[model samples]
Target: MPRIIDSNDKNLIGDKVKALRKAKKMSQQTLSDRLETMAIYVCRGSISRIEDKSRTVTDIELYGISKVLETPIESFFES
Candidate 1:
């Protein structure tokens, strides 16, 4: 099957994720560790890719990110 892309980027939440993580003074590795506690196995490099909009995020990963950042999932799309 071919890949489908709706936007120029792989994901929509990359900038927001980066902003939120930085706001919390959290490193990519730290975020990865926190997500691990939730059984979400996104590694530091993946987290970097997520922030840079180079990776597609799964719903579960999104949920884990929101919980780790203490932000609602909706916030990821907010301006």
Candidate 2:
């Protein structure tokens, strides 16, 4: 059987990421630049999609985000 994902939870992490980014007073472009510095080539639009929960983030990308934001992956998933 296929595992069903929760609709509400789909955006939880993304929302958290957005919140953290905003709390840091950082812009999406800066985040993208940081990701690039870490060799993660996610564009600004992709970041936007991520913040809005329209895009699914990969493990590597998540790692990059965690590192850049100085936040743990667990924090991103916390509701």
Model 1 residue 30 CA deviation (Å) reads: 0.3
Candidate 1 lDDT, 36-59, residue by residue in tens: 999999999999999999999999
After superposing all C-alphas onto the true structure, candidate 1 shows an RMSD in angstroms of: 1.9
Q: Which ranges in model 1 have alpha carbons more than 4 Å from their true place?
A: 1-6
TM-scores for the candidates: 0.90, 0.88
lDDT digits (tens) for residues 2-73 of candidate 2: 537756443456888899999999999999999999999999999998999888888999999999999988
List clash counts for every candidate, in order.
Answer: 0, 0
Q: Against the unseen true structure, what C-alpha lDDT does each candidate score?
A: 0.94, 0.88
Q: Indicate which candidate wins on lDDT.
A: 1
Off by over 4 Å in 2: 1-3, 6-12
